[model samples]
Target: MTNRAAGLLLFALISFAAPLQGQQAPAEAAQAAADQLEAATVALEAAESARDRVKALTGTVRAYEAGLGAMREGLRRVARRESQLLTQLKSREDDVAELLGILQTIETSAPPVLMLHPSGPLGAARSAMMVAEVTPGLYARAEALRRDLEEVQTLRLLQQNAAGTLEKGLSGVQEARTALSAAIADRTDLPRRFTENSVRTAILISSTETLTGFASGLAEIAGGAEKITPLSVDISAQRGELDLPVEGLLLRGFEKRDAAGIARPGLLIAARPRALVSTPTAATIRYRGPLLDLGNVVILEPQPDTLFILSGLAEVYGSAGQVIPAGTPVGLMGGSAPQAGAILSLSGEGGGTDRTETLYIEVRMDNSPVDPATWFRIGKGG
Candidate 1:
């Protein structure tokens, strides 16, 4: 039999093996995987068709990036399932080899010929009895193999579809980047702001080694600048009642260590690509530009002491010192996947129903990073 056919049969036998410790029920796991795949597929379709709604090139990139993230997530889940299947198959090597031998023998002989083989009636009768004894087990194994084959086929199809979606998303991001670069080059008109010190800003950015350090330096600079806006709502009062700027899955929570073992104080939200990014509360734009490592950074001051540092954006809107209302559009997060220092949290804090665009939000008080989850109600619009 072919490797795939052998794999199916092995799955049948091993699926009946004892469940792995701490593993969820197979039905629950299967249902969850199905749900995730369906959600990712839907998000990808939406992203592919959503160019008209988001006219800005930055928004387009964000949307497509979100789609890519969803695709990656779906692929990861499929891989996990494949690994589990392989592990089960490996554990039952002897059983699988025996089954394959039986299949091979059956394929090589006709039923009538097998019944009349070797030493005639006596030997044939013994062989027939042995076959009959194992017939029930074979039937059960066959049924399981059939089910496994169908599931494997479905997963393969999903992987193919996700790869196609990712290719399209990458193309969208490329086109959007070209348009945005052109727009930036031809830029003439822009709003004025209190913290528009180009020379000092450049020096501070060059001096800082980390994003947090850069933010602290900027915060220090903003302290001396003229006040731009008065607080409209008490930021502290709205704790746990604030809505996210965009809707997507939460991949990591505040103070979580990333893949590199570096823990930053913030929440990483995986939103849909091209999804609108607004402020969770009324705030004044402190600064908006590309910082070291971060794609595009937008700093918002909802109150005198509280600064919201949002990074991983592709495009930013509003100007430094611009006072905007609550939920005002500030920028679009980058569409590109994160390279380092990002991983799903152990507690699984931010995994929402969707996985697409990733937006990082850092809350700081007096230049100290604070947990963003403590301020916003997760899994709800608020």
Candidate 2:
């Protein structure tokens, strides 16, 4: 390959290499991550508690509805009572008027003048007349009518007080219901989403250690392993300017979880052409789909073994199984400035009983993951 081609090839190879950082996190990033976890946990727990509150509020609302029903009934009763009292007052008024009219007519009529011969019949009539005269009856009826008027006035006042009481209670009940509704709104997103966030965070935490280990071996060749395969590239133009694919910052370095230079997936190398821009890379079609994250992953296949996964460029444009010549675009090299490396057990979360998705590329002597560096060349600019 010409100098330009070699440089371009180097850029592709370096694209997936990670830089190692020792075991501590930057204070700011660590603090921020901690805060986020705290917030997420609180939110999730609150949401769980909300289920109970929601239930309680629902019950309270139902109770209020029942109370409203009874209040409405009471209001109806009060209305009927007022009507009844009014009817009673009106009938009493009519009876009083009738009595007064009878009194007036009686008063207007001339007194019956009986000519007594100063005898026995006169004496008997005088005694009987005192007891039988309509005047006393009229007076008694007038007194009874006055009492009824007073009683009706008193009953009207009582009805007024009862209606007022009912109105006040209803207002209080309505206010309580409105407060309950506001509380329900405040508690709205309490539980389900909270749980999901926790799950996502946990997965991220598990990857932390592996990322550390992979960073340390960056730029170094993998130890000679049986399954690892290294590809060399060269460019005829632009030489050094376009070949190395390190973005900038070091995301994470070697740690407990890193899968570098050890297991079946032993080693991996990925590439992205910086200067070979004119030639549309065939790697784009070679790795596509769920290989999505592989966004241009480096899988070195030896003359003797299955695929050994290394790393991916931030962006990819290929699917697996398609064969192509060298010098392809593969993908873009722009993830972490330096790149991140993580070692996952073959039994990574989604890996299930069988190993899958973990960076621990399965070593397949015939068909399994052995240590990878044994088979391939993993140099700074492979």
Candidate 3:
């Protein structure tokens, strides 16, 4: 199946996989990511300087974070406003309900009219006339109460719609902020690891020879994001000198995986440094933007035959038409908590929901995912 079709197929598979554990509004998420990332950046700045830099940056970062705190507080206040609105509407609803109840009771308990003894009665006609007048007044009151009830329902609907909009916006802000923070943390630590002498690195890849047949639906004439390049693998060790380009916590192997979970990983490097990504080729940047729960997204098509969807990152390096080597930094990991959802999805104390920024990586061979695990040995074992 085509890569797009494959995704659709998987999507059709009930999408019963673990659902993303977040339900935050865009605004809330954004604010949270931004604050955390800014703090990490400040720390990096502090690391780069001597004596007072840390101290100075500590305050600056604190202030920046505090500012975000203030904004969050404002949002809360708005939420509170919504609550107040709800309260107001509730009160009106209660009032209407009470009035309706009284009307209903009266309608059910209305006394039966007594027949007037017109032949021998004294003041009998006048008594019957009085009863008839009272009945009209009761009917009028009940009708008025029903109208009140209807009005209350209309008000409730309007208030509900408004609240939904605000809530969604809040969630978005939260997601965005959290992802931003994770990216900052990744970038800040990059220079340190690359310069560390004790750091280790590795390049795990498969080799191909006599390659042929690589093109796209829009082949023969393409521009903007279609400049093909061949990627060569260098897996040999160099006289005890490690060719790995990173330090600290490398993921040992590519977890081997197949369309049906039928494979295993060749290597799974645990403890990978958060500085950069390992890609095989230099490709064109096709898309770059914020992806709600995924953080910053970058699409690189290395060849007419191959493409990469790199996401779950905070900061992206190298823009469109830029050259990035195998170990080039595409972006910072969205968060380093093993799973992207730990920090991004959490709000303070996990009161509302969980969120994590995940960089969705999908490789396409002419618009189809060719099971990256087969090549990288990522999904082989697990």
Candidate maximizing lDDT:
1
Q: Per-residue lDDT for 1-382 in model 1, tens only?
A: 2334435554545555543453333334434434444444444445445543223444544454454454445455565664566666677667666675776676687778768746678877866775655545666775565555565566556554444444545555555645545554444343434656677677888899887687667644453565444455566878878887776667788888899998878998876445557787778787889888877889888887788888877778767766666755676655543321232211112334334567898888888888888788788321
**Any idea what lDDT model 1 has?**
0.62
User: Candidates ranked by lDDT, best first?
Assistant: 1, 3, 2
lDDT of 2 by residue, 1-382 (tens): 1233223323323431222232112222323333333343343334334655544433343343333333333333334443544665575565445546545654564544232324456654753364245356546655544654554455345434444433433443344334444554454332210111333334443443543232222112222322223223322132223322221212222222343633223333232222111111112121122232333344333223233344444443323333333333233333221111111111112211111112222223444545433432223431
Worst 10 residues of 2 by lDDT: 338-347
Q: lDDT for model 2, on a 0 to 1 scale?
A: 0.34
Structural RMSD, model 2: 38.3
Model 1: lowest-lDDT 10 consecutive positions? 339-348
- In order of appearance, the predictions have TM-scores of 0.52, 0.24, 0.27
Q: Which stretches of candidate 3 lie over 4 Å from their true place?
A: 1-286, 291-295, 335-357, 379-382
For candidate 1, what is the TM-score? 0.52
Residue 382, candidate 3: Cα error in Å is 13
Candidate 1 — which residues are off by over 4 angstroms?
A: 1-63, 90-94, 100-134, 157-161, 173-229, 241-278, 289-297, 310-316, 325-373, 376-382
